[model samples]
Target chain A: MRLSERELVSLIRRKLARSTASEGTIVGPGDDAAIIAPTPGEALALSTDAIVEDVHFRRRWATGFLLGLKSLLSSISDIFAMGARPRACLVSLGLSTWASPLFVEDLFEGMLKAAGRFGASIVGGNITRSNKLFIDMTVTGHLAPGNAITRAGAKVGDAIYVTGHLGGAALAAKHLFGGRIDRGRLAEVESFLRDDVAATPGDAQVELLSRFFAPPIRAEESSALAAAGICTSMIDISDGIGSDLREVCHESGVGAVIEIDSIPVFDRLPGSLAINRRDMLRLAISGGEDYELLFTVRQSDELRLQRLFQENDLCPITKIGRITPNSEGIVFLDNDGRPSEGFTGFDHFSTKEEGH
Target chain B: MRLSERELVSLIRRKLARSTASEGTIVGPGDDAAIIAPTPGEALALSTDAIVEDVHFRRRWATGFLLGLKSLLSSISDIFAMGARPRACLVSLGLSTWASPLFVEDLFEGMLKAAGRFGASIVGGNITRSNKLFIDMTVTGHLAPGNAITRAGAKVGDAIYVTGHLGGAALAAKHLFGGRIDRGRLAEVESFLRDDVAATPGDAQVELLSRFFAPPIRAEESSALAAAGICTSMIDISDGIGSDLREVCHESGVGAVIEIDSIPVFDRLPGSLAINRRDMLRLAISGGEDYELLFTVRQSDELRLQRLFQENDLCPITKIGRITPNSEGIVFLDNDGRPSEGFTGFDHFSTKEEGH
Candidate 1:
């Protein structure tokens, strides 16, 4: 059932139960502005993103509730990618004049649903008028003296790994475009996708698909990995492996020679997903919005990482490349040992002509 | 004249000379993921807004640099409105293909300039491809104990006051629509608008416009306002006096009786300005995005508030309204003692049709 914006806000409030705001939460929600405590040494993390009507999704493809959920997830995902647990998320919505208060409520419901799952609360946000339905969210997280992680931590010879499979979201996008659903086929596909719903033992394909649609991961894993002394540098694989990896490499002042053959790809997948084997590498390399953690570890720590994965039943850690001096730049080497041409992973600006 | 995104980012980084995630900045910038500390018992004040192409601005009216600056200001303004000092900000930009790295950088330049003024730092953000220009930002602030202010704090018999004058931005916006540079009259306009640029008087009007388009007035004044024990409740007039006051009253579970004539309106603006008095009042009441503080003082604290203003050389605080029982709701009475039928306040969603 579709939820109303008010209902959604209530749900989000429920999830925000964990945030105490230190007895300084003079006003939490249900107000135009929320009151908070001010600390001299403390700093805040602020960020915003918009999910446009046609650009981000189709109204007919998903309920307003789902769209709302995705909108919250999209920005919160950025917060998570920053390696901070979400403390609060504020939304500024743009709605069509014809939209009812209920529609907005449903959008909030979707957002609250997602937010509830992540322990973040919606403190305060704005609703603006617009010709289109736009969902924009800004999230804040707290990081004390030495807890936050950044992209420049990778060291030379650090092992690279990912939390989930690469292309299932892309596959889901294809299925969404076709608007066809077969439970029987879906179940079979789920076996390969492993949606991380409960983690019933299935083949790698179901796990991969599940990972793509809903990557099973959290910030807790970063702590776990950190406690194990395994991660050297890290990133969330929102864009495919290549693009995301390139980010880590570039920021860390390292160049990597990745073996194409080492990349994990789903071959037993059905339903005619767009990326082929060659393109699969590309998708794994560049398809954005994965939300899986991608990190590098010193080669010496690989054993510890493997043990953590074994104990946690998280996705396997793979060694794809190493961090080298920036003098080498970032290069993708094939199995035969040659450099490839044309490696612009994704540019939001350059693709405007194609309408995103 | 425009700056590149990279160059802009570099400039912004330069502007934020002291902002270091150093002690706890695990993940600064240029990373797919940033990690931060999660301090317990601290509720966060978070807000997000988007300044979209065509929706929020006219490219010709505002430079790419100003657009960037405004985007950052909008986010920071939310933080200030909460009476919270900014900690960190995240930006997610969807750029049109026509925009170059230079153009993106210029936008960042504007944002950095604003950020520098407020001491807020850009910690992390994203870049993506889109058909239109979209700048989304989230700002998070920390509030210390007993310092956070909320609209719900207002009590019955409380007096209403605002930080700056109203309607000037609306007037400026109207004049801007003509797009004719009256260079000969520029000096007059600049001097007249001097309050907005912080070159002259520190009254409601000047404070209002400055808060609208520039870095927020932080720390000392707020601390002084709190220390002097004047405000019963406070809110930044992001929306105009009418709507913002409505929010304060509604949240406080009280109704308000506003004196239409008593509300401060900008005067001696300009001969060519050609703005109507009622229109100016309407703009002051209905026009959004002022970002000035709207606060209430208990009757007992009125003298203190006056002394505070006198001490600061600020404009005298005008008594525009009174908080009443909720049963009365919001009532705006004019000089003739007639009841108004409608209020033209801005609802982000409702105002979509207003040609903002």
Candidate 2:
């Protein structure tokens, strides 16, 4: 049934309900905030995300169920990226006045699916009338003592490597935009978008596609990489290599040089929208929504790191760049021996006026 | 210096940088989510509230500093009202992309001042381009062992009491809106609005006007009132007596009979508004932005409650209503002995389409 945003909010409030003594909730909705006590000694890692309806998802994208899953997955991936286990999440859903009950329910169903998959609970949130459809998730997770990984640890001499293939998610998104897909084709696309492919699996080409949709590396890998004393600074190649690597340089107080020929790119992928292999590199470099981990390890451990990944049947590793002084900024050496001046990446909300 | 929303967001992000230590923060920003670990046993409390540009605050009612304080106070008030001590806060600021840096700074100053008053730290937030000014604060508060307070615990026949005076904050708000005060009049206004002016000392009324701009209620009061074994259920009167009480009754599965004459309306209250005295009752019942506590107590402990509040010099305790079966819903007992339907309260984002 069609429902106003107010009605949807009221329904959510009733369904979520207040916490009882048995629920271990000290404060629940209808208060200034909900409160919970953490198990002692654990440091909290906090994250917040805003999802604009049209920009982030399409009404025709899969079902409301898939849309919910993808929107939530987009946020959960951040928790996974932090190497922290998911804990409690507060979801703020902004419903335009004209939303429908079925639509809202389907969205919740999607969210529940993702929440269950990640083992996180929806603890508290605010539901209010909004001009646009916006869902913002404030996810809080705890870190085991000293297990949290950051982007600052990569050393200058460490070899730069990335996990997974990097263009399929964008491709999947493109396909969704183009129009309807058959069930079998959609299923294949779904599997391809899962977070594990690029994070693990050593087939160099398979891993190349993995980076495009979902990256698989976790804090455990960082622990393993760091424990072995093989890695220095690290970053996730989210906004493509060029944009993300720029952040690593800015954060680590260093610059970098990426050898275009050495950078991994997926080839021979079959999809409705066909493009040149050169464009794939550009997508790999500037095409975003890729969640792959990029890191720097000692040059000496380069061979060891490659062997480790290959032994685990993951993608073959590549040495794509070396960290340099800030004075170098970020220089990209193309296959033609041409150095590019600037990098381009996606800014989804930047182009719009802001209310999503 | 004047700054845009982007500049403001950058400042906030810089402030929060020191709070996070997670290595797994692959894509913190410029992406869909800030990925991180779900640390074990740590429960996260997420809360969000939005304040519109004009409805919530006047662009010139107070300094940008004070506006920021009000924004933070309004949101953080939710955390404290839950009996949870706030730990960190995330703000999603949606202002006209053209807002000046000075305006943004003023907002931050207000927010930081309020945070300092409550001992809560500002951690993370987002900034987006928007056509109108919208500041949404999502706060995470840490509840002590088994100590979160909700609005559902009111037992049958519990006496109701409100901390501080009612209507004074509303008075202060009205004064600020008319914009008649001069610079030298600040001290006079502050003195007149001081907490001591309430019929009783230590009443929240006088101080509330000052706090109206920023209501200061400690988390300790929850325990103090709870320890007295008098409060059955409680809520902060944000949307005025009538509406908030309706909420308390609805949550507790009961109804209430409010006496029109019994509600503590303010002295020297201006008559400038188009609405009349009866409408004033409507305002007291429904007008919002007042953060005074409304709580229920055992009938047997009514005397003790009065004495306790008196000892603390709190405003005169008044019993405006009593809880009845839900079938009664919420009724107002007029001097003519007629019962009126429910009162309308403020909904900040309500627009012409709502037909309120």
> What DockQ values do the models have?
0.33, 0.31
Cand. 1 TM to true fold: 0.82
lDDT of residue A179 for candidate 1: 56
- The CA lDDT of each predicted structure is 0.60, 0.59
User: Clash number for model 1?
Assistant: 70
Model 1 lDDT per residue over A1-356, tens place: 13433344455455444444334345676553465543324434445566766655555454555566656666666555555556566777665655565666556666666666676667776554455566667666544334445667788777777775565555554455455544454456433322323343355444444443345445667656645555767777655676677767766778776766677754546434435687767666765556667788888888878888889875656677777777887777777888766443543333222222
The clash numbers for all candidates, in the given order, read 70, 66
DockQ of 1: 0.33
Worst 10 residues of 2 chain A by lDDT: A347-356
Every candidate's fraction of true contacts kept comes to 0.32, 0.33
Candidate 1: tens digits of C-alpha lDDT, residues B241-269: 76678778766888888888887876646
What TM-score would you report for chain A in candidate 1?
0.77
